[model samples]
Target: MEGNESLSSAMQERGLTQVELAEAVNTRLICAGHEGTVSDRTIRNWLTGKSQWPHPKQREALEAVFGCMAEELGFSPPARRQRPATEPESPVERRNFLTATTGTAASAVPFVGAPPQVGTSDVLRLRSGLDALMELDDTRGGHEGLERAALSGAAEALDKQKLGATQRIRLRLFSIAADYTATAAWSALDARQADRAQALLGRALYLARMAQDPVAEMRVWNSYAMLAHQRGALTEAIDSGLAAQATGITKRDPMFASLAHARTAIGHSNLGDRQAALRSLGHAREALGKVDRDQPRPSWMAFYGPAELTAMTAIVRDRIGDAAEAEAASHKALGAIPKQFRRNRALATTRLALAQLHQRDIDQACSTASNGFELMTGAPIPGRMRSLLGDFYRDLITLAPDAGAAREWGDRYRAEWSRA
Candidate 1:
């Protein structure tokens, strides 16, 4: 009941779908206020728990539909912390996590306290001070950049701390560092930069351990498993994924846990462990059922949805020799995703093409592969699609070597990707 079920049940008991409930809440907003206007996108954002409106009126609107006490949902909506616009966070770590997750840039921050009057001098001060520079770097690079800088900076900062003025000025720097490290490692993994990814992750793990934050620690383990899986290190990936789950396998974040399981399933399939693969996939689906969009997810985990899950299902089915089933799932996932994510569309499409090949649908498979190839060439690696594309390309070459068109396609892929 503490899961997505809470929202679903609340809606059902009230004879409402999420949309209907939100509409009712909006109606109440208009009745209670000067003007009531809500965008569908804003409603979706609220339901997803990515961000919330802090206005008392907005809270009233939410209560109108979701009920007065959010307790039944087993959570208190986190209160908004309004940092002053004047206290602009340093550029480095802020961009790393904020840009990718929230799409916000290095802009002024607004929060509850006395608005910080950040100035050129303040920026210059941090720029010149080693400790402040570490904080700034931690903000900009996220945590990944901090690892290298912290090693050098921490020694100097610590030496002067008791004797001078460090803690008073750079309050919350540790928390910022921890968050940044976690994100930095996460970013490297997305780009398929594994060595750098691992190195950054090492720093993240150490910091998370120091902070005793199991949530962050578990996330880094998940990152390690995912990156390892992408690199085709099956056993290592499986072990790392299992360790991540072990850190906290409660239903609190079943969807993310399922993602880790899905990663393990892929690794198992790579190792030819058919039974293990299927079992892990079931784990993925089961976990997905437990998430509520209204809770805060880790910064690195905001992308999962119907499309990504279906695409993953297609990949898993293909790996286990259910070509027709795989093709069906891939097509469904492709249809669900937006056109802006062209790279993912390509990756999913090629896998479907491979499935078509298995079914002797030669022309269609060729068509699909061609589209995927085009997508791969132009984009800098997409955040999510890069791994899937790598897997597809490697497998595509092995699929229909004797067919002339397939061979041509394979050769072209190799030359284009610099993997030939």
Candidate 2:
């Protein structure tokens, strides 16, 4: 029997382990007044094609859990009553059909010898891959492997887009490609590979425009703003932030608008426009306050909630010479940030250290900065975080060239830096 790629893809998209899926199915089954007998082995069987058709009640529970038909999850009926695979339904049609028969379920047989077709299933599969990569980035930050993997995903989407499909599906594939390329660009940017990041963002923006996806386009422009800032093109950075603000998604999603405003604030602060920077920061906070926290957002944007916005505020405050306010913002960000976001926490720790250093709390700054190394002990520090540490080191030495704490902090970081 052929493996059930569709079901596997769906599970991956939901970030479900075999045990989790089984538990979910059992929960639904219990809610439907049926025995909760499904186990991890059952899910494994389904994935490995050891079970082509599950019990009828189990099928119903699966449908309820996934909000789609069993056939779409790659299950097939008995061979004696097998049916041909039909053309994939449009998203609207498929949703409507599924909703019309919510509690009922049936299975269909697949064609063993047919070549794989590019459709919604492929889209789901690619999206699952993207989700996994994004999670990896959250924990480890950016690396060469991540950049290459992201480019590979973009290439896969581009290749799939060349195949026969509806306009909607074609656009989705192009959008996926843009998202993947943008991820690659961000990875390179985090690694301080400015030239490589610039080239990738250019391609991502073109693909985003081709896909007519304002959210993806906004993401590209946000990255463009960051890349410009890294290259010391502060004016271009501000313009790019404005370009992000101009995207349609920013109008529709307050969270996106807030992020755009925050980016602009950074640019303005660095360019010595203290009044404009604070004004933009206020706008960012106001916009963020209007966002509906319960609304579902794409995985790529999982990083930009209150904690991230607060961190951005610290950046603005620090740039504009408000060390006390910057220190308070960094503390708030650290408290609000989730523990799973190791990279963000480490970066925030660096920011806290910077703020302390600026205030001449040399001993306290070293202590806070040491926490960054502890937090990211198992992983190589991202270049961006390393650069931040470098800044702190330079400032510390300049302020206290002969201090005992300065010598010890310098010696400690030198060892860490060489290892990194």
Candidate 3:
């Protein structure tokens, strides 16, 4: 069957109406913490070929829901273009390098030659560029545009393989490069491109190892844990988290150790080991207490503060069905989270809503949920946040099927999805 036909057949097999399919897709997007939402009209257009190629995010949701690739669903992949030799030293060139180095192309290394002599100024420029990209990610979600530019720039710089640099300078460059690579990998994970994320993370891990920076190595391991946790690989997540903790301990970095322990707690929580989760959380708290507030932290770990830790605690508590404690922790998290981190605020609100629902406060839960939804406007939602909202939506419906507030909340959610 052709793409439309294949899609239709899949829908038919699942007995999903166009509206149902749209809802399913939106639910998935919400769970993932993505920004855009699909409407029934969009799905109808896709089916009727009125719209040919959905956005990559939309395509990802459709592929996930239908269990098929874009090609299998009758959507043609973009035509490949050959890269020109001796490309300009621009962001575009760098992004191309990143795209080329990842996925199936990973086995093939791009052309490398001794070109420019590396200097301190060059390293500083690269560092500033990465800092800008990271700032963009923190303020806005991981937009493909920014992520591509950052990834490409870092890859291009790394490809130069600066020779004759001092060992200290070389290690610094490698550490910075690895951090940038890890950030790109995180962006891939947020976009639901698991293969790309894995490839980037693998490269980052190598760079970290080469740099011999325990802090950088720990950061990579923590990122690996997050990726694995997001994909539901609990054992791998825990193992990575443990590895990070080991590095933190070896480095004697309290902040890194605290964050690593919290990550381990998440893994334990996901595995339904409440006792283990709580114990790990306590360890995190203890390590965090020992952290000197005056010391400078690595850029990657800079966001790991009391607010983040509190939010994590709420997540673990909620997982273990400690509704009251979860609600308290969620409130504290929300209060402590910085205004600039809109996504984290939204996620904490979601947890608060869930906690309220657990307490059978449907009205309060709906209000809190509505607030969370509002926070997501104009921001790219994470899959985890979307998933949390989806769960809240489902629970609201199940628990209060006949309540007017629940119905209103549902209508608000659907309207938001349609507009998304």
TM-score of each: 0.55, 0.73, 0.71
Model 1: lDDT to the true structure:
0.57
**Per-residue C-alpha lDDT of model 1 across residues 23-122, encoded as one tens digit per residue:** 4444434333324455555555555654444345555444434423333443344456543446434422222111211222343334566544433343
Q: Let me know the TM-score candidate 1 reaches against the reference structure.
A: 0.55
Pick out the ten consecutive residues of candidate 1 with the lowest summed lDDT.
Answer: 94-103
Candidate 3, residues 189-222, lDDT tens digits: the string is 7655677888989998999888787877887788
Candidate 3 lDDT score at position 275: 93
TM-score, structure 2 vs. true: 0.73
C-alpha lDDT of residue 136 in model 1 = 30
Candidate 2: Cα lDDT at 356: 91
Candidate 1: which stretches are off by over 4 Å? 1-176, 339-342, 376-378, 381-399, 402-404, 407-415, 418-420
Runs off by more than 4 Å, candidate 3: 1-116, 162-164, 248-250, 418-420
